[model samples]
Target: MNKSTYITAENPMSATFRYLAISIMFMFVGFLFGKLFVPASLVYAANIFVVILIVGLLIFSLMSRKNVIPTSFSMNFVYLFTFVDGILMYPILTYYLYDLGTSLFINIVLSTCVIFAVFAFISHKKPAGYFIGLGNILLTSLMVLLAMTIVNIFFNAPVFNILVSAFGIILFSAYILYDVSTLKHYIESGRITCKNDLSIHVLNLYLDFVNILLDLLRIVSDLKD
Candidate 1:
């Protein structure tokens, strides 16, 4: 339950499980939110909500950089908001899950693969933290996601869509492991001390849940069809 317990390297197994549990819980909340608001207007509401959340995250990150804000509160907010972002992203992904086909799915998979590859490369060199290459990775990932989304407008392939959902499950699950491991490593090594470190831990849990939920959703969708 404590944030510190979630990132201690000395207890990776426990931490990993805890991290996964956190992800699962948040994912369920996201799913519930999606289910409760199942309507055309949900998409618009989600879009506006995500936009505001992103703006707030940006503003906080900016202020924190200047050391103008309290680290504890700022970091806690970061963790909380990032969790919300991760939860909200599910609806957006859900909206597109069945709408995209093979080509677009392939594009999304390839894009994600490239992002992981880049993250792997950067981490090998730095092996310190995601923040080191966060800006570049985030930008490139967004570009690829946008490109894939745009291409979907031209071609909608059901087979590919299913595959994308499957891959998303795998990719995001692996990310969960990696994120949890690194977080634990950081804590054990005395790299992370402040509560702000919780932001990154929470973010990792959020991504894990998102992908796991996507995988589950895809399975359900397939069974239904």
Candidate 2:
């Protein structure tokens, strides 16, 4: 099919790019703040920052009638939500599950398998349908991860924390690839149409980078322990 077939009234690529740049700037600022202060405190602070970011984006979406935001922008936004859900929620939840020891790794493997399996099942669908489906899956997965994390806080343990972190690295890495591919397809196929779409693009990109940071933090934290 021709690329123009997917073009909507909204063009999100430009806006998505701008959002991605802004997010990167925030990351640097957050990083520097962490170095100057307590590392753990910085993480917690970032958690709050991410939550605020989500609210801001949602408001932006609600304000704009057209969802023509760039794929990159939406991708970053998705990435950010993943970070808030994963980093802010998972470790604490797994703290209790840590008592489950290496068993928690099973959770990681299972979740990863399920996510990829779902992706594979629908990858061949129409681009719009495929993305919408994928987004729903990721969102659902985050919900599960969040629940587990909340539970972990009260039941804090060390071993489970390690497992969760390791798994997060792998899972988020896979998502980075998945998200990048989706963005490329959307842009190349002319699937993006409006400001809302652009927001989605930025959201995904933010999610990818933020998740990577979270994974890295877990890796480092575990090693230090």
**Best candidate (score: TM-score):** 2
Candidate 2: residue 142 lDDT (0-100): 50
Question: What is the C-alpha lDDT profile of model 1 across 1-225, one tens digit per residue?
Answer: 455564443354344345445554554565566556656566545533433433343343334333465433444354345446555665555454444555554455455445544543444344445443343443344344334434443554556555545555554444544554466557557655544544555544444444444444444445446
Which lDDT tens digits does candidate 2 get at residues 109-166? Answer: 3554455445433443435333444555554545445444444455656676556555
Candidates' TM-scores?
Answer: 0.47, 0.48
Q: Per-residue error at 150 for model 1, in Å?
A: 5.0
Q: CA lDDT of each candidate?
A: 0.48, 0.47
Candidate 2 ranges with C-alpha deviation above 4 Å: 1-19, 30-140, 194-196
Clash-forming residue pairs, model 1: 101-157, 102-160
| For every candidate, C-alpha RMSD to the true structure in Å | 9.1, 10.2
Lowest-lDDT window of 10 residues in candidate 2?
57-66
